[model samples]
Target chain A: MGALPELSVDIGGLKIKNPVIAASGTFGYGDELAPFYDPSLLGAIIVKGLSLRPMPGNPPPRIVETPCGLLNAIGLANIGIEAFVGEKLPSLATIKAPIITNIYGHTIEDYAEMARRIEGVKGIAAVEVNISCPNVEQGGMAFGRDPDSAARVADRVVENTTKPVIVKLTPNVTDIGLIAKAVEAAGAQSISVTNTFLGMAVDVATRRPKLANMVGGLSGPAIKPMALYLVHEVVKAVRIPVIGLGGIMDYHDALEFLLVGARAIQVGTANLVNPKAAIEIVNGLTDFCLREKIKDINEIIGALETKGEDHEKKGDRKDKSKANF
Target chain B: MDKSRYPMVEEVVSIGFNREIGKDTFLMGFPCVALTSRAKPGQFLMIQVDRQAKDPLLRRPFSIHGVLDSNRLMILYKVVGKGTALLSALREGDTISAIGPLGNGFTLPGPGERALLVAGGMGIAPLFFLTQVLTRAQNHSVKMFLGFPTSQDVVLIDQLKGLGVDLSLTTEDGSLGIKGLVTDLWDQTLSQESTQKPVTYACGPASMLKEIAQKAIARNLRCYVCLEGYMGCGLGICQGCAAKAAGSKDKPYYYVCQDGPVFSAEMIDWEVM
Candidate 1:
């Protein structure tokens, strides 16, 4: 009741400062956005997806535009796991908040190798296994689409690393809940819902695809509704904590996911549009909870229940009448 | 990294509505920009266009076309994608976000130095400002070779002429000037001025830049080429604008956002380009 309690939330065993994590590929390593925004303000940072070896990523035209969204096929162009530990990790240790590394690989071996390397790095609070990279021919969307593949990939990573594993799920799948359950069953500490949507943009003039890879993963505001639906469904299906992200541009949008049962949220495409998005969300959440007289932000996490409602609960909910047939 | 040095757009002043400069080019003007960093020739601004636009959510990077410094700045961009297309429809007083004086600017030679300015299509945007700088210096002998698909694509020709530089025109179909890419004219020009060590400056498509770099290297001339890549933050954080470069001692892959959008021809890892 006093100042919205603390904004702190626990993911795995790691206690994040807040519920706002800079979504993968948006914040880059902590140092990139350091000039524009204060890095210590966020709960955690999920760096760009890293693989076993360096990836040049896709050819040019790797990005295209859609309504209120973007499609990118960067193919996880990173300095590889070795450089991240050797060069990037040391820089991360300086930041005050926990750093969550997002790992992506081409094969099970690739994931295992990266997991082993990152497990020992200091300041890496947890690891988010990205099984939904569609640009790569193998290991990415291939593992994420099927429950067994997703479980096996998650299991291999959890086996190799002592660090907490939060398997990121892809919305492109038919059953996101099934994938979340599989990931949790495979020993994933938490589940991060929704990577990017498999979408394409055409030049219309040349009658050719906008991206060099022909099709790219779509993110940003356009995918918000779908991401929220997936997060709601996953939180209901899984016992483990769920980190929701997709077109989370403002605090209210993030609150929607929290009310629907997301333990925390990641700001992916929004970081690209506004560098100050993550900071604003953190401040806004604190302000909202304070104004509403709600003490733990966690109190709202997954508060939605379908059980037979009491009369007092019905009176508290104004929208319940709108739902009345 | 100087925190205070970063240039943030003070305000989005001018919204250019459907102001198409060329068939593929669009113009976005900002009446006010925070001049935190001094912009020189070849430097650029990472323009976040239509933050409110739903599709094409990312910002588009553009070379600093010209900055008046009174209370506003103008960016000459081509509508190559959704970002710029949305920018083209902006209004005069509407605000647009921009981060700038980004990437390294073009390196000019000493006074009275002879230099060849080569540009293709919209690549000419950055070079136009470079021309203004060079002509204002009046120390360098400047000659410009501009190439286009056809005569119609020859934008900024009259503008370049007004700058009072030795300008030559080329189009593929021989509609306006010479035929073929800008390098073709450079090849012939280099043959005549073979004796003088002319500093080469160019901005164009990757293919065009590669060919120009090859020709410059073959002639053993010092050249700086403006390279374009997909950008995220425009401020070096995204690492999305990364390009490989041979380092002096330790680091090899240099970030285009930090190290350069303009690099010495020999320093580039040509294979990647």
Candidate 2:
């Protein structure tokens, strides 16, 4: 009977209608899912990572399914910056949601050049620096593994583009918190915690690695819990907003990240599982808020009740739940 | 390429029937009017075997086997892995999610042209559907050569015969028609044919298809092949199913999910594939 819950969220300075974002690579260049649903319904859309030149990606047998997970070595195959801006951006710009361009490079200069090319592009609202692609041989996860290199990639992108810079971190690191702090200190406005975890599978009969790249990134429900812990760690380490993503298949998973203080959440492999996943999460979040009688979705952000909390507050929460239901 | 002909639908439809036709092979049909009405012969479906389980995280791709009553879509699949094993366990009335008429289908033979369908093992899934379409056309003649490992692996013998096509069967064990591969029949069949405009459509193992592609190219015959690969998203998004492009300088790979589950044999680098 009251107004709908407020779902809009601000990822640093970039504002979106909700907190469910379509992760890069999973949601092609924003056109692939048009048949399933209107992409503008999501908080934002991150197109596949683009480089200075078109990438052919890895050879066939690039993906294999594991227990509750998917191992993919797509090798960052994309249509390049020029093709995207010229071919995809015009149509994508028509959508109401903010379009964030995910960029990666093989070198520091390649990263800076990609940032410069899309700097004044009219449709692009933000730039997500992918310092964390595990499948690439050169600059991808190499830059993300070291704190100083991660900061430099962020600093260069921030310098090249006026758009808000979001440094996406790789989970295949010793201390993710240190990398988060370094990128935040380097002037990145926001950070998306956790790209796919490095993993691989093998065919026992053939004794051959499942992926052509030998090792690929593991994603899906198998990585959700670990991703949540990493997101929580990054949130505690950085002052900038954190976008949580790993194995976010539903709204419950999205809420886990938000409770840990992630500003938004990206639906990656889940999109491959179900193209309507992000939109479904958006609907689920609204239903959750309405059921709980929460006025704004942000009220639950970082509202996790840890151990040793006041007994009186815990009692009040129980009493409120009993009365609301 | 009129997009309207191939309308992609993502729906959760209930299974109409699931029957085992041969060893480790099952023919399952679901009543999806949206898919059955528009699905072409060589096109396929991405079926989520178990909607509630996550171990088999991704959907399994199946070629459109046939249509029943103009509303039911059927899939002929073998239990080669976990996904198909789970699909085989699914019974009538159970529900599953599927996305289809996903990729391009076979290009139908024109009037006065002869249709030659070559299927090896489970490759018969799509080619069988093509045979059904080809036989229905007034002026076209359909000749099918199907090869399986043994007699027990062969399926749809009566049904295929009911269609009244010139069907030849071959089994490696010599338990069915011939003791040799299906390509052995190619020389005899092609030499006996009087039609100069015979288009070849094949689906099966890469090695088998490569041999057929080579023979077709040598004879200057028009050939199209239906390809299969492990796919993440049946839509072109994941880029997981990359097939080497033939002699393409600018683009090195063709996404099997989008470009062609069905392609002209000449378009693929047969040696690498």
Candidate 3:
């Protein structure tokens, strides 16, 4: 096979070697995935959620496995932004791929503070605002749930740093389109959609909640369809690029995201099963493009739109209809 | 320190699903792991609970308990969280991913002196292998001080005793052993000792380890405390498990995944623990 054609793409100010990047939290700082696989192959690695101060995160047990999905109530445990610059960022400078940091805050100032502090870091490519965090009080869900609040945060960060800001939208909202449009209108260089849906798990024996926090954001294969729908909606709503993510495990799913108008794709829960999920998806996409006689793989981007809304709905129904449980 | 050996899972048996541990903790009972790499007293194994299972993404870590030979290693762990919980639900014949004999185990045989091993809760797991190595090393005399919450909480005691080292016990309710915390017994033994340093090794709750570190300092005896930290990557990359070492105060901190899940008493930040 003629060494899968170089699948490079640039989104916002970031230059990705390929269109595949490991979603935040799943690829903890770049080094965790370094030992198992090479980091150079990835488009970029989004580090776990970072805060202004060190957070202990939710009390244990923090994770649960649902069929084809996972529920994590880690509560954004991180070493804080200062530590990221002091310890983590310096280390990532050695890797070839661009490094994207995901920032979470309880207030607008926290988001600005993180962006200001991380400005001009040597290896950082951009900042992805994680507006969907439901566990926190001041930040997280408060900002992402509403288009206005989400845009405000995105705008503040845009002014705070020169680095391209990608606003990550929440799928728990009634209309992800409005939120996507709001962030884009606020001058966001790019928008990444569908940060885990609000979910809860129960103990069958005790009739109690499984996660100590009671409710958590759900991700993995189970949330892919929702992710795709949001990605599709957001792509149409915004003219700027969109980074699509949610339960994306394999290349085929990633191809679907590209067809739905995602300029880039983030591999989230799939990294849990395989640390090399993003690299594999890139390789798979390359292979698929080559097999389909596609000269420019970018042609596949937004390919699903050609089917029209009705055709896409029918396709989704047929796929879900065959799904066993 | 270096991953001289990559991890490979030898077996996976799901004893059952445990709701109390978590909604997902599979009580994956692995009969054996490949121990050829030689994990000392405090080393650990990074276990991928179910190779084929997809929901729980990252590999869960466990402390290595016993190494029978180059071909077989044993880990003693409770079903906690999605990784282990899912692991515990597997059938008799299943394969899981295990990478290990990682981390530097405790230094052994302190100048031909007698040693005492103290464990609290699941902390007792790693010392199982430590005892065997100590007994076999000429000139090193070993004893074990084990504690659990209740009778059913007790495990590996008979196995430890069968190794023919001196043994004592403690329980919170005094069900089957000495009453009170394991530290109580450790304090009693240390307060009275003067000439015999009795190098100590302990594992368990962070609070207990902190107390043990304090007692080790107070008693002027050498001690190694195995630590526990939340991890995203069992390897040192995540920075999720970075911990402050007691003596390294002037310096930054150490990564538990890499620097140590095991650190010398003086080396660990007992206060934070």
lDDT of 1 by residue, A232-321 (tens): 999889999899998899988898899898899999878876788899899888877777666889987877766898978877675642
TM-score of 3: 0.78
Structural similarity of chain A in candidate 2, as TM-score = 0.96
Quote the TM-score that chain A achieves in each candidate.
0.93, 0.96, 0.92
* Model 3 accuracy (lDDT, Cα): 0.76
Candidate 1 docking band: acceptable
What is candidate 3's lDDT per residue for A210-320, written digit by digit as tens? Answer: 776798888888889989989999988889989999988888789889988898999977775566667788888877767665666678788774544687788885686
Label model 3 with its docking quality class: incorrect
Off by over 4 Å in 1: A1-5, A204-207, A305-325, B5-33, B69-71, B79-85, B148-162, B171-182, B236-259, B266-273
After best superposition, candidate 2 residue A284: deviation in angstroms? 0.3
Cα RMSD (Å) per model? 4.2, 2.3, 5.8
Q: What is candidate 1's DockQ? A: 0.37
Candidate number of the best lDDT:
2
By TM-score, highest first, what's the ranking?
Answer: 2, 1, 3
